[model samples]
Target chain A: MVMDTKQPFEKLVELHGATVLRVCRAVVGPGEADDVWQETFLSALRAYPELPADANHEAWLVTIAHRRSLDSVRAAGRRAMPVGEMPDGRSPLGNPGPDGDGVWDQVARLPDKQRRVIAYRYLADLPFADIAGILGGTPAAARRSAADGLKKLRTLMAETPPQGGTP
Target chain B: MTSTDRTSRTGPVDLAFAPHLTAIEPGALHRLRSALAETATREGVLDIAYRIVDSPVGQLLLAATDRGLVRVAYEREDHDAVLQQLAERLSPRILEAPARLGSAAAQLDEYFAGRRRGFDVPLDLSLSAGFRRTVIQHLEGIPFGVTESYTEVARAVGNPKAVRAVGTACATNPLPVVVPCHRVLRSDGSLGGYIGGLEAKSALLALEAAP
Candidate 1:
């Protein structure tokens, strides 16, 4: 019956892990998302003691995730290996309509800034300002990138209209 | 509009991946935590490792210091509060990584399933000291399916007059089941106060006595 407050970082993983993993997968693709996810938490654990106690934890995690995902991309670049194959419309894991258009592939193919903005804003539900903070730009710039990314995604989906429910 | 709210007007740019976004393999987080614990241990910074395990009574909060399994608590103990106690009495650098408690968890599993008679996990007794520490240590020798009177436990530890203190020790045993504190009974052979409630004490005794 002893009362206490838990400051363990474990709660953070239970809370924001899905969002962070989603951002990683959306930004870097599933092939590398798990590694980026690992790196993000590892970095968070190392620096957790130094983080401001009142800091917005979700934003802090996204910030770490953004930086870690970029590190993974940069490391991949140094190796110059071809990225993994995009999900074909027929992925067993993907909910495909009559014509599965590989929506994940389309998201991956967007311009880098647009992909980052969309993932930061939508997947992680971070504010444009926080996304700006992580990706280094003004809030307006992040918003514009998200809008542009959505415009392109809407156009692409118009042609095929990603049918069927979630996989 | 808030920057996050404005994104909603952008026609669900994340819609295409919403399903995937909502789901992450539980294993992914587990693996990440395992790796994190490993790196922190290798770097000599991991102070406490813990995981939740279901027992005959209910979900238990099993925590370990770098030294050994330090705390095992029942759900009624308020896992969050127990974690907080662990953070305070132990260290703030605590994490929930089941891999670190695999052996202890397995031993508990076997105990609940009625296949194991004893726990093999190393224990960190830093949480208890003085008479409480002595009483808790004596509890480990009580043996499975056997009950010892609190007065007897106090006597075993050279403090026969500290019967009430022995009862208090059994009530506050941080590593209750693993330390076999439930095996300690009142002088009248009745269940005494259990941090997890008398019902839990009865349940544990019943589980151990099961054929």
Candidate 2:
């Protein structure tokens, strides 16, 4: 494709911005998702001119988003907590808001590999082959991880009944 | 990649995750977009910034570079095609950042309302060059409500035999109303060709002519 024939970067953001944000929130938690989202696109903008016109824009953006989420998670680990006392409850990766349905909180409880598999497959709608590439595993293994994650979620949801439901 | 039985079992997960997928807050997205635009500008990656504004003629597309306002296209020109041409001609790093073109839009608004005579916004005349550029530069000197013949403009630009060339420049003027292309007329005192079409030419002339 001709160099000048490329669509503006704004169109890319408009098309995939929300999906990338969802991926970021699911991967790094909502608290740091915005920061990661901004970083992902800023990096993308820096490289957008060189991206091939035939490239899969959504997958390419998801890949960038995945890397940014990892960076956010690592940075969050290195930051010193200001709280004097630590809570006795499990230190889930994300904050399960007071009013939220707590499905996300259960997702936060999932093992890292399973959490990432679910996020990439379900949230980003990426194929297992793509997920395997992102997570460094075989397509079958990625599929197994997704199944395991869903199975565990179902068990967890069953054990903890939906809050504020009908009597 | 899976069988029907497996899909049925795993299908519930998709539904459960659907709500979280769309958890975007409009306010947060707006803030993120604004912040991203600012950072792009600061980093000098923003090549062309554009926005649309309503006018008596129609909605006008205003585009600017870091130097100054570059292009002002009327609705009849097909804004999308114009933008595509801009992307091909300029860099592809374009954004719909209204703030960068705010001053230009305001000045145009003032001019359209008949409160302002001359445009004070800095212009990027890169789209026009050579004779066309010289013709537009001279057109700016014709004053707010005055008219000039294409023949007279040709002579003014030191090319007495270039009357047709002067008309071509006015017809291809990238910044129409701002460059005052509507002020140029045929030798018979009739309106000549305008890039924004005849109705817009009439509208602009009438706006300038009104008391």
Candidate 3:
């Protein structure tokens, strides 16, 4: 019965790991999502013991994920020296839009705050308060960002023809 | 699925694109687990990496902390139960991934194969404390192929009259075969009860006694 003790950390990973992955991917694009996700959980595991038992587990993990995403972006910015010709801004999602994972491409085109609020609110299903807690704003601002982000995403989706379609 | 967990406010947002969002990140979890282990070992925070090896006696459970080998268990001790005990005693942040146990396992392999007499690997004896810890430490000094009585072990630990307490310590020896608790026998030159059962005690002694 001792083994049946609080394994909340492993359970935390099992529950929200995928959503955290998507949140990071949405924020920083796929090329860096893996590192950021790993960092987020590693930090979570390190601090897990001291965490309050009554805390919101999802918000806590996403908060960690949010910080790690910024760290990866900063690190990549420093290491991003000039290389060969840059790819077209069109391929920002780092994959072919025709693959029908174009949601990522559209999500990639969104402004940073809108992208994160959408990922946290819709994709990860965090409430506006948790999203605001993670991204730092009032809950009303979180809700506004979600609405604005969704409105822009709809416009983009409507006007942009599918990449492989006859035009 | 929607009735209980994962319930969320869809609000007024269109969600036709939710599938791509919820689609699992391929191989991301595996990468994260590996990263966790690597960073934990590197950072020395709640690291609980372990490995298992078949011995001349039985399959042994080998676990290491950030410092060194922390535990060794016999097959009869139930390796799963042993791991859980470790999880309880230490942290549940354990993985059976065998990351930092290479040297310890190889030394144990050599000891079993009769190539080495004394262990050269570091030990994490945090599991033992106070009198029991001191008794076990004295047991480690008894040498390979040599035997000591529990009274002598008690005396070696500067507690000559604590014989029964010494037996209690040996009975609860967390590292067992690796720490050589089996080398402590009855003062009348007889095998006493071993945490690993008497036969394992005899096997270890016999294995060491072979010339």
DockQ of candidate 2 against the true complex: 0.37
lDDT of 1 by residue, B1-211 (tens): 2112222333375443444443455566667667777877777666888889887688998888878999988898899988877766766677776878999999888888889999998899999999899888788888889998888888899988998888888888989889988888888888878888888889889998988
Query: What is the Cα-based lDDT of residue B113 in candidate 2?
Result: 84
Q: Of the candidates shown, which would achieve the greatest lDDT relative to the real structure?
A: 2
What overall lDDT, based on C-alpha atoms, would model 3 receive against the true structure?
0.75
lDDT (10s digit) by residue, model 3, range A1-167: 22244453455666777667767777777777777888888888888767765677778888898888877755665577544433323323333222655566776777778878887887677888888888888999988988888888788777774343321
The candidate, 1 or 2, that scores higher on DockQ is 2
For all candidates, state DockQ relative to the true structure.
0.28, 0.37, 0.28
Q: Write the per-residue lDDT of candidate 1 for residues A1-167, one digit (tens) a residue.
A: 63434477777776777678777887777778778888888778777766665678889998888888777776775566544643222222222212343666556556777877888777777788888888887999989988987888667656654444544
The 10 consecutive residues of candidate 1 chain B with the worst lDDT sum are B1-10
Segments in model 1 whose C-alpha atoms lie over 4 Å from true places: A1-6, A81-101, A155-167, B1-11, B16-46, B92-95, B109-117, B143-147, B155-161, B203-211
Give a tens-digit lDDT track for model 3, residues B50-141.
Answer: 77888878888888877788888888888877776776678767765566788888888898888999888888999999999998788888
The better-scoring model by TM-score among 1 and 3 is 1
Pitting candidate 1 against candidate 3, the one with the higher lDDT is: 1
lDDT of 1 at B170: 86
TM-score for each candidate, following the candidate numbering = 0.77, 0.86, 0.69
